[model samples]
Target: MKKIGYLILIICFLSCESETIETTTVNEELTAQQKTVTTNKNEAVVIRFIAGLSEAEKSVLRTHYGVTAYEKCSCGDENLESWNLEAIHEGATIEERVSSMEEEPEMEGADFNFDIQIASQVPTDVISGPIHYQNVLPKIRSQKASVTVGVLDTGIDPTYFRFQQPFLHNTVLDEETCGNDFFGWNFIENNNMPIDDNGHGTIVSYMIYEQLVNTATDFQILPAKAFDTDGKSTLFRIGCGLSYLIKKEVNIINMSFGWTTTSSAIIGSYIKEAEHNILMVTSAGNTGENNDEIAHFPSSYPARNILAVTAVDGEIPPTLVPILSNFGPISVDVAVHGIGLPFYTTAETAPTSVTGSSYASAKAAGFAASKYQEGTAMAVFYHKILLDKIQSSTLLQIKYASYLDL
Candidate 1:
């Protein structure tokens, strides 16, 4: 078993929303395949329990170790078998906590920012044009069950005109709007309203919403506002957001954010728990680094259900993505057109653009939702579908998998 991957990790495991308008055509044509852990002023330490912690261990952690401000990550009704915790460590350093923790029942895993924001600010290109819509209609119509996609990013702009369509009304709430139910839970503000204060979730959701809207009308997006206004998040918040999604039992989940760490075992465990139930899509990350060489959490977590996406631009599958995009035959599964695409959200009067693997992952989630069947090993089955569709090309940029151009 892997030990704690410490904050400056060589670790992994780990782990958005939008609106509608003219229906941004994300994948018009074929394409070639493709944050930081920070400390808070409060100095809280993050831990993941492989098995729920026993009362005795908790007592030990608090009494002897000077751990305080304990908080357990909770899902709505779904009790997660494996759980994550946040507590204020009184130790001088994380290394001190670990060294002194020698006698504790084998620390499963711990870290500060297991999963941080996937930097989406690198501008690859600015798209401006007449705004052409390509995916005129959804792909699958008469499916057995309607698909619900979990958007794990900043809260979505629920008021977006496209998201307000009658079809998505029930999905927006996910549950009954008792007093003031919103799209999904907000881990940041501790409220039901996960409305997007930052534009990242809005844009990410726009790509997904446009794709799903074009493909099928029965789809719904369950937005869990994981990131705050600064596009940053902590492990506890991310775990909580994921827990909410898992409890909601969505068909597919789009994780547009991730951090780089070789020691992301804690986050990986949470995702590992969810892999059996939901199909997950994540960004391959920016920084123009090779994911094959470096470690990018969730994307590089080596899970079957998680599909890591990289960005591309335009109609034909590009030989290479923008300089900011990360690619790897091993870590990344597919590539999509998430860059240079003009998108309009409720926050924007005109089409706007930004660069990140977040958009590409959203497109993949939307596409997967369009193709998702009711009863199946969704993660494995959909994963195979994407991998099989991979165009057999050179292993230059897209080393193993092919670029997805639909």
Candidate 2:
């Protein structure tokens, strides 16, 4: 009997081991495929190297990898630096160059910024109850303050009626004079026009625009077009946009996009670092998985400045949680209802209804921006004040997996 019991234990252990190995192999395979799809086969790729490059090191990179341009990035530490570079070499693949560079002592931490796919969710318009913003304006007018909110997504259509409305005039910032940027828009494609060929950015930007307008708040929208017409961008471009916003001292940033795989460590590092100073608001993704169980970058990152938002539906005793919106008690910070909400499109197009945590994130970001206070201490306190207002006990009851109770 003892021998038989020992045999059963061994069999159970072997079976569990086999299952674990199989699961790991499948996960690795899927991850590899995702990485491959994200790779752009274009002649050029973006690379970030350990910073503080000597003239000799820069010359070596220029000669060896055909580096065309480079910029220094401070990944949290001003003293510790990182360099973003655009390079082209006919013979070698990006992976090959990365591996070769890693073997060199000086270039140990060199890495490529992989492409980031947009979190696309087309919203359809629906007649909904009032959100109190239009009414809330006059009451809070005395407390209103000027704030800058950076929309890091597809470009906004400033010609739209919401932007053109006389009451909302001069809310959009003047074109940035910085390198490769334009007034009210900046594109990663190096094009002078930052128009939205895809409607996602326009829709996302409107959520913030409408909120500020309705509340009669003094605010400016800095539209940074990191994604292209296909709704695609890379960590390199996104990082550049973030750097631009940081330099401008924007009080809040809205990133209504994300990816599942931990593909770009450098970009992840940037997100983590940005939270040190600016309020970073991001979507919790649409995967429907618990982010705490399966992490999401920028959202699940352990940062006090990050407000990870998930989606809820219907207000008057809100109950529905979008089937696709990711949620977690620990990972997600708040929830907002944007599903089936009328989204503003281009001047030529009619408004449409939209879904996904993308809109939720935008709404939260706009709310946070509306509640912005000037001082560093006020910034923290006011953010909490806004959160308290948002996480009402009644509303908290309706949110899925929400930890915030007010």
* Number of the top lDDT candidate: 1
What TM value does model 2 have? 0.67
Candidates in order, TM-scores: namely: 0.73, 0.67
Model 1 per-residue lDDT tens digits across residues 1-406: 1122121111111111122222112222222222323234235555554356676765665555555446654333222222223333453555566445433454556654443654775222222212111111121122223778888887765444555343222322334332333346777776655666665676677777777778764677777887876677876787778867776788788888766644445567667877776888888886677877877777888777887888776555454554667888788877777666665533345644565677778888878877777777755567555754557453257645466663
lDDT of 2 by residue, 38-119 (tens): 3443433445455576767757775686565554432112212233334435777556776776565554244555667676
- Root-mean-square deviation (CA) per prediction: 11.4, 19.7
Clashing pairs in 2: 123-353, 123-354, 124-353, 124-354, 125-352, 125-353, 175-183
Q: 290 in model 1: Cα distance from truth in Å? A: 0.7
lDDT of each: 0.60, 0.57
Query: Which residues of candidate 1, in runs, are more than 4 Å off?
Result: 1-42, 50-57, 74-93, 99-108, 122-145, 167-182, 345-350, 387-395
